[model samples]
Target chain A: MGVVVPLEDDRGRGQNAVAQLQALVAKEMQAVNEFIRERMASDVPMVPELASHLINSGGKRLRPMLTIAASRLCGYNGTDHIKLAATVEFLHTATLLHDDVVDESDMRRGAKTARMLWGNQASVLVGDFLLGRAFKLMVETKSLRALEIIADAASVIAEGEVMQLAAAKDTGTTEDAYLRVIQAKTAALFAAATEIGAVISEKNGSEAAALESYGRNLGIAFQLVDDALDYGGRAASLGKNVGDDFREGKITLPVVLAFRRGNAEERAFWERTLQQGDRQEGDLEHAVDLMNKHAALEDTILRARHYGAIANDALAIFPDSPYRQALTDLVDFCINRNH
Target chain B: MGVVVPLEDDRGRGQNAVAQLQALVAKEMQAVNEFIRERMASDVPMVPELASHLINSGGKRLRPMLTIAASRLCGYNGTDHIKLAATVEFLHTATLLHDDVVDESDMRRGAKTARMLWGNQASVLVGDFLLGRAFKLMVETKSLRALEIIADAASVIAEGEVMQLAAAKDTGTTEDAYLRVIQAKTAALFAAATEIGAVISEKNGSEAAALESYGRNLGIAFQLVDDALDYGGRAASLGKNVGDDFREGKITLPVVLAFRRGNAEERAFWERTLQQGDRQEGDLEHAVDLMNKHAALEDTILRARHYGAIANDALAIFPDSPYRQALTDLVDFCINRNH
Candidate 1:
């Protein structure tokens, strides 16, 4: 007997998956847009201005997509998914506003950051507003489990930020430390986004755990790929300049891996760029070359792919469905994307 | 029928009120210390360090005291007051931590700010952590009404901060704008602190409304007194240096009143110091003299006293008890306080 493959046509699985994902995201994004606009509109004019600036500034809305997709995959056929998705997006936007202020970052996605455009004070306060708004939406959902997941995720995200602050530009930062930071700052929200869907939909404990694991692994993979692109990807492709992380003296996975694998002369080069916090002309190119020579970028990419595969495997508990296939494709996209 | 006024030594209504209020505050403070310590401690060492630096710093702890006192007067006997009181303190600490970062302030309460000690990044992230911890505590209380009140207050506080940022050094800022800002930033928390007790105690609608009114009025009075002190009060009396608001270019109530009431020559003096954001030597003293000449400081204090009276009147519906009198005294302290 011949094995039946799901994809025989060149346009079969990939096109269908992309179309489905796009449709789902478009619908969710509309809901998120409406929720944000309504919630951000206040008696004060500045409230809407500050909030709209960040919310509408071309964020990919990846976190909300996770929420909507997860809920649908769990067979939830309710409008609460929209609220949960908006809650996820609001939480993500709040963190970004606060993060830019804390990092003193002037630019994001090739535009001036909210803190730079409005002011640090506006950014910080608006961030607080978004957080509160997220909670209000959660309460409206009437799911205690959703609240628990989000509250825990928020705490972890804050912890991750603190860890990053402590570790930034520090030569002694370890791989474990870097992982912990990513888990707290990036992965926790992703986990919550997917996990809350199962929680609200009343999925069994094992299934919910599997979905959460998938999200966690996929988020780690996503961040790892993001860090890799910071070194090698084109500025236009990524919508952010190359070496921006190095400029910020952020010791991400590539830097950590390069340092671990570097020879004595390479180690000295790393020290000069990262520890001294001074980058002369051609420093970014030189650092990239060193990372390439050490094969650190390749190794990091491989690790990301490994996590992506684990994420895909975690969905085995779910029956065969187009949503599951799209989730698998998302993991692949996270690992394989050039930007 | 002679109105029987109890002697001071008799431990009657007046004496009992003082003793009970003090005992309640002391117990709440103890719990606040524990909650703050426990919540600030993280697996991330830097988190605990930065959080403790701010939380352990010498704040007056007035907000938490208000929470405790209000709860007690509302007939709360459970330990939820402990959590609520700690929640209030955490919210205040979180704001202070964020404010220091936004203000780029080096000193608060005569010591280095958390941002100054650890860097703006740590302060911002740790502040975020404290805010999340506050919500977590509120959720543990299991009262949706308490959650709603606190969440709304948090949003208002942020909105107020944003309003202040926009209005700072802008001559277009009116007294109404200042009132709105104060209500959102200062009075909302004050209202939350007092009203949460009535909410948790399950008081009648009118009783809860009265507490809310009292807290809002008291907060306004407290802030008015603070603004007055910023203009002319001695550092020894105020615990904060005078004219600090002037240096920071903050347009408070006295400044607004002075600007409106001043003549052309006086207005030029105001513009030089506030609108132009340029302060020469002796500018602080000149501003204070101008405030006095315009009677702005006196007017502000009178307004504070009026609010203080309103706060006392809110308690008229409460059963006469020693706890109620202490609350009345608190209103006086808010309006009359030098520090």
Candidate 2:
């Protein structure tokens, strides 16, 4: 019973949606959590410590939830999905470890990052360990198609990370490039998670494709909302500080649009702050102020809504059931959550 | 086309031995190189650039060679070994990238390391990219058992790395602990590479186990010599500067042996240099002098000979062939190589 998302206000449709989805798959999620804990243990103390610090903190566990819900929706009744769901979580956790090291991030999920406490070496190696463990678990499933899909997802995530790294602090990045980056980094795993469910359930034709589209669109919507939230002026209310993107000179969709639409003076400011990495006090406030004036944040949300709608439509092919409805609610929750 | 190991004055049995092994697998290795080049290319320029720098830096390519040679030795005539061989190389390259970053090393194979030319972040992400790519290749083989072996090897290698990190400067580390670390960190990949060769040939019985033992022993012998070479006063001739491990406060077998055999004053010196990381200008030379006095380096080579002999014996079950002869010669090459 890890806290789901840990938003300050837990009394709304957003909370109910996630709570509903998690409850629908509580038993499977238990197996997933158990698999995660047992597989994470090693003779090396830091391996477990570093993993527990991030995993046990307060993740939404949305990815594994997606795996379970989508699998159940497709009528997967075997024990292999449990292993696959745990595999999905392991892959996600591994990337987070490396991402923190690459980004030099200090905080995550309102807690100190693994790299912060265990040092970069431990973080990198343990991340590799978890990744290998994930591959081993997927292999044990003995589903070649499922393994291939997850392997492809892992490759795309790495490429997306590198693409993002190359574009970091470059204010000239376009919206298309930004979208592609998010598609690769966030959505690939999401799509794979759902697609594997349909795969393992022997529904590999239209159902797998539909679930993949659902997961993909939902992932894009999820990331767009996350990027928007950084400047939503509610960063402090969440686990991460508000305007972390601005502090890190990360050029999100809002910044990309604002930079493209800004006047010469504004463009120069963007260049100086992001490209030159010359951030000062009040810079974040002014950046948000510019975004507001240009309706960048609102537009970002609008785009998320567009993808969220597609995600909703992807689930329409399946009959109305608690599982389908819960997955549908997850899309709404992702787009509407303030945190 | 790549120079295999580039030892100075490439003459005599050691050179002939490696060259002989390489010649037996020359065509397959060419295919392996092509696959590596093709798969390493990305739309991201830095991805290829970073990979080319490390992979093309004149590595011994012994792991992949082992993959090919052992596969051929098992009378394998199929082409899946090409992909598997390339996967082995990619795995090795990925580990090297991460190792250099963790070690903060600036030099490798007498060239600037990927971490040095690019940044640690690039090295980390690119290493990740290569690792994912390796997984994709292995899955293509569709051999569940082979996939499991490689995945397990990758996991153990990571655990070994973390174990090494734990034991980095602890002079109190015993020989057994040191052997275990090397077994996980270095030998696991070697064992897996050869074992997979036997496996892909459908020789998963005694042949697989025998090849695995051969690789494991050969790898241990190879590493023992490398650690000895670091302090053998031939460091300048090698691509890496001599006493690098010493300067990094690395406690290898030589240091481990000398420390255990030292008197009180020498024991204090060992603690001061490696444990406390307080090295004076004369520290490296003094360390080597102490090692020589205690016959530590000589004993380390003697230990390597012990393993090398077992590696030699592991191949007795195989019939006489050029492949078997070349592999046998490799054990000698590993134990006797100066660089």
Candidate 3:
């Protein structure tokens, strides 16, 4: 079994939640992991090498786990969930590969990125291979609905990436635009991951809709927390250095809120630092100070908690079980986790 | 109608073949074009802009035409061929987008590439969007077999790209390696395009295999002519500067043949110019001289003609029709065209 490293202290709720989720879907996740390993193999060694470097590099496989949990929560009792869960993970992994290239990120999950090791070309091509394999797996399942959901998510994710690229470093970005970006970049796949589970389980429309809502809200909450964490002096805890978004000029929720609420002087600071990317030493500290002055980080966390509440409520329709409770606990972990 | 600009001062056979193919599938080709336009639309304008910049930039739409011609040759009457044609074109276009980024070429089809106008990131992301849309189109067809064929081709194409990258600039690369690269990078899609045509038409196994062979051979012939053109003083006619492949140190068939037949001094020249990419002034002209002395360009054309003959033989099983005649002429066009 893969090691589950919970944070230092939180009464082990995080550890218990993950362990419980793993226990519930361990078999299916194993099948998904095996499928990923087998499918990632290629005659071209770079393809598999770069793919596994990112996939096996301590990610929780949380998206696929969500897929498995949602399927079981909906009373699915078939083998196709394994295929769909793998498909979901493939799609997620593919996007991560490209995102690192696009974001020019150097680290992921506390390690150097594939792009850092292999360069952009391998990352792009291997990402394409993973996507092709994902589609192949979906074809193998022979589920048109599942195929539609996942494929639609892929397009939306691309669109979101473009939108985010266009919106980056622009301090004028609104909360609505930020939400749309995160929804497309992060939440669309999550929603699809869960909804496809419901879909493969032969769940009815209400159940599928509920699962989608749960996944979507949970995704938004997860991203909001991440956005808050970037400037909360806990970036290292998140496996990425703090102020990366600041350096990259990525105007996330905190930046958006701080920019909108700040005075003219602060607005000029944002324009110089973010819009123009004219950052200097101590700019991150000053930026965080402005966020503190406006309560941007706290407000961002509050927003995440709000979405987390909605996610928790969305699961109320389903009967209570260890699986359901584990999923519910996942929302809290997403909101409360440090690393 | 989109303009079809045959190269100037050429015998019009290439133009005639294209015209005949277009005439044979005029209505279906129109439908496929419309579908491509519609599906390529996105709320993110860059997706459509860069897509159209390449799609509408004078491509012959040959792959989609082959899909239409193949289905028609198989006596298909359904509308699914339109979708498949669009899918084939999307897959081909998507590959082109990624290829431009991978090759770092600035020009294609006599115009600046999408990467030249947008950046590498946009090209990669938009290519991905097209692939997603292509899969979505495949799912709409509800043909699991077709989906598998195309998805498998996608993986093979990516594998081919990685393989080519590995082989690039290596003077010691064998003819076998060159052929393998072209087969994956070009011919696999061609085979899938035609095979799916026969498949959707409910053609029997032999017919499907025949079309696949026909397409695969035609694609090989087409790429061989292209490789020869890169060294035959007709590179500008192909809308690229002469010696681009040489400059990029791509080990195509001509380079392989020339390297194998050259004297020791010539081999040193190849190692310095290609393997080390240490070209000086007049290197391209001297490389061309070596290619001519070794009959490398001529032999490459001879190889293309050989494949063209095989492609022709593969199509002999089908009945006589304008479509069949046009496809047969296409082989000759591929073999003889300078651009």
DockQ of 3: 0.75
**TM (B chain), model 1:** 0.91
Per-residue CA lDDT of candidate 1, range A88-170, in tens? 98889899998887777888877889888788878888888888888878878877778768887888899998888778877
> Tens-digit lDDT track for model 2 on B1-339?
111232444236766899899888898899999999999988888889999999998888999999999999999999999999999999899999999988999888778888888899989888888888998898899988888898888888999999999999899899999999999999999999999999999999999999999999999999998898887632322233677898888889988999999999999999999899999987877887888788898789789989989988999999999999999989878876766
Angstrom error of the Cα, residue B87, model 2: value is 0.7
Chain A, candidate 1, TM-score of 0.91
Give the per-residue lDDT digits (tens) of candidate 3, residues A184-271. Answer: 9899998999998899988859899999999999999999988877886222222336777888889899999999999999999999
The predicted structure with the larger lDDT, 1 or 3, is 3
> RMSD to native for every prediction?
6.0, 3.5, 3.6
- Give one digit per residue, the lDDT tens place, for model 2 in A1-339: 121232444236665899899889999899999999999988878778888898899898889888888899998889999999999999999999999999899988778899989999989999899889999999999998988898788878888988998898789999999999999999999999999999999999999999999999999999998888887622322233677788888889989988998999999999999999998888877887888778887788789989989998988999999999899888878877866
Steric clash pairs (candidate 3): none
Off by over 4 Å in 3: A1-15, A233-240, B1-15, B233-240
DockQ of each: 0.62, 0.72, 0.75
Candidate 1 C-alpha error for residue B231, in Å = 1.9
Runs of candidate 1 exceeding 4 Å displacement: A1-19, A233-240, B1-20, B234-240
Q: Which regions of candidate 2 fall more than 4 Å away from where they truly are?
A: A1-12, A233-240, B1-11, B233-240
lDDT string, candidate 3, B1-339, tens digits: 121223543337755787788888998898999999999999999999999999998888989999999999999999999999999988888889988888889888878899989998888889988998999998899988899899989988988988888898788998888899999989999999989999999885998999999999999999988788887532222233567788888899999999999999999999999899899998888888888788888788789889989998999999899889999988877776656
Backbone clashes in model 1: 1
